[model samples]
Target: MLYLVGLGLADEKDITLRGLETVKKCSKVYMEAYTSLLSFGLSSTGKSALENLYGKSIIVADREMVEEKADDILSEAQSSDVAFLVVGDSFGATTHTDLVVRAKKLGVDVKVVHNASVMNAIGVCGLQLYRYGETISIPFFTETWRPDSFYEKIRRNRTLGLHTLCLLDIRVKEPSLESLCRGKREYEPPRYMTINTAIEQLLEIEQNRGESAYSEDTTCVGLARVGSEDQVIVAGSMKQLLTIDFGPPLHCLVIVGDVHPVEKEMLEFYTFGKSSNQIS
Candidate 1:
């Protein structure tokens, strides 16, 4: 059996009781680290923390291992019970879906364990989950590649008065361009996008497109370190949020649309200097 488990959003302890049981019984445990991350990150200490709890040696699977060399893991699962863990819910990223497809072709049974993810956790901003449109991911702008494909989706969502959740890019262990040409891989340091950077990039795209999809004065909510003890949430216009700093990584942004009265009240609690407008 192949078990794909979600580790939730906070820490090692966030693993569900069933997930813990699956991990303990699995022949091998692999943690997929590229999509999203937990509060402490996958540092040495964090890896050790998971090992201590699972009572199993955890293998850190990078993008190369998971995307480029997934066969190794699948092969192991074919003969024995192997656990592939992910941050957030099991289906949060499409990569996991592909893995399941491959496993099925090989006649390997797959089990998914769901947990909290940004898709649903964004509700903390008070926006109705059902009112959210198709979610979009914003990639880092490269010198020759500034894609605005997500802009159209955001526009459509706003036209229907539905909120748009932006999942920022996270580059982990990405190979340097020059090294790729040299036939030897040299990875660049991991980078986690912040709410500030995401906003700046969004505004830049709007300027070039001039589509009026969204403006600097448009309302937005910046969330950082979500599900952690030090999680920070600030609600304000895009222009206002640009000047504000949300420290730490694992950030997400929400483009507000036609909000309900209750959502307005709930958002007011995190709005700067607007305590009187607290949510009822």
Candidate 2:
């Protein structure tokens, strides 16, 4: 049996009781690291923390292992129970879904364990989940590759008066372009997009397209280290957020659209200079 377990957000303790039980029983456990992960879950101490709590040692699986070498894991699961752990809910990312499909085709029975993810935990900002439109991911802008494919989606959401959740890019265990050209693999330092950088890139895309989709003064909620005790939630204009510092990794931005009276009132609690709940 193959168990696709969710570790949830935050630290090691976010694992559900069922997920914990499943992990403890599995002969082999793999933690998918390239996607979202618990805060500090990759560091040596963090791994120890999870292993100690789950009562099982976890093998760190990078993007290559999960994508290219998934068969090796499935083959092992064919003989014994194995658990593939994800940071958030098990199926939050499409890659995991693909893995499940392959496991099914390989005759490996699979079970999913659900848990809180950014998709739902984001509601802590007080915005009604039903009011959100299609979520969009913002990739990091490069010198020659500034992709604006997501711009139209954002505009569509704003036109319909729906909130747009912008999931910032996360680069982990990525091969350097120079190294790829050199016919060798060299991983670059991990990068987690900051609210400041995401805002800058969004503004740049708006400038190039000359579309009034969103302005510098557009209200947005900047979130960092979400689902953690020290999570920061600051609501302000994109311009204002660009100035404020949202420390740490796993940051996300929410572009506010037509807001109901209640949402507006709730958002006030995180507004800078108004609410004491501002980021520390």
Candidate 3:
């Protein structure tokens, strides 16, 4: 049997009871490391923390192993129990869905253990889940490639009075350009897009498009290390949020569209101001 388990956004303790039970029973356990990251991360120490708690040795699966070498994992599942751990909910990223499909094709029985992900955890900021429109991912811009495809999506959401959730980019173990050119494996340092960089990039896109998709004064919510003990959430305008340091990796930005009365009231609690740097 193949089990796809979600280890919520925080630390190893965030694993659900069922997920913990499944992991404890699995003969082979693999942690998907490329999609989304947890607050504690997957460093050797972090991995040991999870192992010490769950009492299972976990194999770290990068993009190359999961995408190009998934058959090896699936084949192992064909005989004994295997558990694939994801930072967020199993299906939060499309890659996990592909894994399930592949497993099913191989006649492997699959079960999913769900947990909190940014999709629902963002509601801690007080925005109604139903009020959110199409979610978009903002990738890091390069010198030659600056894509603004999310601009139209955000504009449409705002037009319909719905919030837009911008999932920032996370690059982990990415091969360096020199390595790719030299046909050798050399990884660059992992980069997590900050809320400040995201806002700057958004403004740059607007400056180029000149379509008024969103302005510097537009209201937004910046979230960092969500679900963790030291999680920080700040509500403010795009320009205002830029001045606040969200601290640490794994940050996300929410573009406010039409704020309901309750949402406004909740947002008021964390609104950017003198005491805006409060941590939960």
Candidate 4:
């Protein structure tokens, strides 16, 4: 049996009881480390902490291993119970779905254990989950490549008076372009986009596109280390949030659209200043 388990948002303790049981019963356990991360990250201490609790050694599965060598894991699962752990919900990323599909094609039995992800946890900021439109991911902008395709989606959401949840980019174990061309892989340091950088990039895109989708004065919410004990949530205009230090990674941005009176009242507690106006 192949078990795909979700570790939820924060840390090792976030795993469900059933997920822990599955991990304990599995002969081999692999933790998916590319898409999202826990508060402790993938450090040796963090991995060891989880290993001690689960009573099993975990193999850190990077993108290459998961994408290029998944068959090895599937083969192992064909004869023995194997566990694949994800940071969030099992289906939060498309990659996991593809893995399941491949496993099924190989006649392997697959089971999924669900858990909370940023998609639902973002509602803690007081924005109604039902009012959100299509969620968009904001990738890190490079000097040579700045994609603004998400701008149109945000614009459409705004036109419909629906909120937009912007998931920040997280680049882990990414191979450098220069080394890839040389037939040898050299990975760069991992990068997790901050709320400040995300806002700066959004403003630049708006300026270049000249679209009225959003502006510096637009009401937005900056969230950092969400789901953790020290999580920070600040609601304000994009300009106001730019000056605030979010402190640490795993940040996300919420572009407020049409707001209800109740949501406005709830968001007031997180506004940049007590005297600041409510979300518009």
| TM-score (all chains, Cα) for each model | 0.95, 0.97, 0.97, 0.96
**Residues 4-24, candidate 2, lDDT per residue (tens digit)?**
998888888899999999999
Candidate 4 lDDT by residue in tens digits, 1-280: 8999998888889899999999999999999989885345478998898999999899999878999999999999999999999997899899899999999999999999888898998988899999999999999998799998999999999999999999999998889999899989999898999999999999999999997899999999898877887788899999999998889778999999999999998888888975233232
Give per-residue CA lDDT, model 1, range 99-208, as digits (tens): 99999998889998888988888888788999999999999999999999999999999999999999999998889999999999999888988888899999999999
In order, the Cα lDDT scores of the candidates are: 0.87, 0.90, 0.91, 0.90
Number of clashing pairs per prediction, in order: 0, 0, 0, 0
Error of 2 at 31 (Å): 0.2
What's the distance in Å from true for residue 28, model 3?
A: 0.7
Model 4's lDDT to the true fold?
0.90
Task: Look at candidate 1 and tell me the lDDT of residue 236.
Answer: 92
Candidate 3: tens digits of C-alpha lDDT, residues 1-280: 9999999998888999999999999999999989874355457888999899888788989878899988999999999999999997899888899999999999999999999999999999999999999999999999999999999999999999899999999898899999999999999888989999999999999999999989999999999988888888998999999998888888999999899899998888888984444546
Candidate 2 ranges beyond 4 A from true positions: 278-280
Backbone clash tally for model 3? 0
Worst 10 residues of 4 by lDDT: 271-280
